[model samples]
Target: MNYKPTLIFGRISIAISLLLIVSLLFIDCNSDRLADIKETEEILRKADASIQNSITQKNIDSLMSFYAEDACLLPTAEPKVEGKAAIKREWQHIFEIPDFNNKSTLTKIEISKDGSMAYTMGTYLATMQGEDGSPVEEPGKWVTVWEKQSDGHWLIVVDTYNTDIPPPDHK
Candidate 1:
């Protein structure tokens, strides 16, 4: 047996194994960060879907449930509404409007690595039908800031929306 050559190859193999182990440890340490980011993204997606469904179903309470206590909203052609109660009132007012049919299309969703914060921007299409069944279409965009609470609940911290194009056939 060539003892010298065999011993040298064994030492090199052990060194490589040690390096690989250290590399895996580093990767494992950051795995939680990636998981946090993924969780945050999922939460935002669920909130978006909930809001869209709420709008479609005309469920005002469900629509506003994802808002934080101190959240703020900048609605089109209106003053900013702050706090959860005010936000709820705003939704109620919209829900009370006759012939309001709205749907959202999520165009983008981005989240932070810590999973503590995120923002989503998307387009909204609303059709308000007249008593005679004539539909008036409105297209707009919205951006929402979401924050993960201590209790693992995600809520909108800030919400803003604006109309990029006026309603069809408007004066």
Candidate 2:
């Protein structure tokens, strides 16, 4: 007759063990999701800064560092430039534009919940140094798409832009 107490205790232990296993599984799943979210945000930040830095410095070579080998750029006014070489030429032409001396800023960087992709869309204000070296500011907007590489690096998959104000020649 003391067997009743032993049987009840064994059942309670088994129930508690099952609950612990489910709780652990849930926790592990949540942690993995959180890590993915963090990684996605980090990639977004890297892409945002890389593009702004490239434009501000007008460094075509440095700018290409962020691009994937097969990346492409679709300019607002011109045909799409596919591949790193074409993109480099595009940047070179941009740097040579009249009063091309300028700076830009980026904001509103966002990433998908799954963290596989991201984009940075923002306004840019650039100032051209006059022949007198005085600053002239021009503002525009840009959007860039980013992909996370298998090596854990983020690269620009697509780059595109549009100016808030048309080029002075157009006006």
Candidate 3:
């Protein structure tokens, strides 16, 4: 046997083996990442469901619980409301309105690679009684930023929403 040819073939085999191992490790890491993303997405979906349920029940306390202590609420036609207390007050005012009804449909949700943060974009339909007892509906879009807490729970850290329908009397 020619030692030169045997040595070259041995090196080639080792290189191929190393490449295969690396490829397998890369694939396994990616699979784990995908699983993490899916899990995060499910958690966010459940959270959204809780929010909807709270709104349906008009439970301001439960709804506010979804927000972080330092969360911010950017409402349309109003200044930004910062902190849990302010957000709770804002929701309380909305809940106090007679015939108030709101529904949110999540259009998209994205999670960070590290699973430390996420965001959801959705459309909202809100109905309330006007001053003359007339039913009014406002269609809008909203984006909420969520952060993973130390307790492994996700909470809304920032929320911003605006109406899609333009205001009346626009020239």
Candidate 4:
């Protein structure tokens, strides 16, 4: 009845089935990870929007809440400021400028493959009173790094920005 050929054919079919199953499993896992990454991006987008709202409302504390306790701020024309206390002081100083106002728009928010970290690229328009007591506009781009906390909340670990305008001497 040629049972040897039938047996060999059965084994081949079983092997092919196993390979297909394994491939499908791998693809499914990757799809799940991709979905997670997309969801994380949305979370960051919402967070970015909330932080900008805090700025518009002039809520210093709310603005600071987005930062980690040991965050760092690399402000323009200054050395790096570390820790929440220092960052808060920097914000306070900026807030002190007469007629100070800022508006930020996020351009991109990229998530790490592991979904544990992310970074944001954004631009800002800031206005403050100059030495002549007239509103001075400062347009700048900023990049902020974020880490997802144990509570699933993302906080800024590093925030840095610089103006587009060149130095007076260079102008």
Candidate 1 ranges beyond 4 A from true positions: 1-19, 130-134, 166-171
Would you list the rank order by lDDT, best first? 3, 4, 1, 2
Per residue, candidate 1 scores C-alpha lDDT tens digits across 1-171 of: 789999999999999999999999999878977777776777778879988898889887888788899999999999999999999999888787678988888888888766678899999988887667787777899999988799988889999988877546956
TM-scores, each model vs. reference: 0.79, 0.71, 0.95, 0.92
The candidate that wins on lDDT is 3
Clashes of each: 0, 0, 0, 0
1-171 per-residue lDDT for model 3 (tens digits) = 789999999999999999999999999999999999999999999999899899989988889889999999999999999999999999989899889999999999999888899999999999999889999998999999999999999999999999988788967
* Weakest 10 consecutive residues of candidate 4 by summed lDDT: 162-171
Candidate 4, residues 1-171, lDDT tens digits: the string is: 799999999999999999999999999999999989888889888988898888777788999999999999999999999999999899888888889889899999888888898999999999989999877999999999999999988899999999999888853
The local lDDT score (0 to 100) that residue 51 gets in candidate 4 is 87
Error of model 4, residue 42, in angstroms:
1.2
C-alpha lDDT of all candidate models, in order: 0.86, 0.80, 0.94, 0.92
The alpha-carbon root-mean-square deviation between model 1 and the true structure, to one decimal in Å, is: 4.3
Candidate with better lDDT, 1 vs 3: 3
- lDDT value, residue 78 of candidate 3: 100
Which residue runs of candidate 2 sit more than 4 Å off their true CA positions? 1-20, 129-137, 166-171
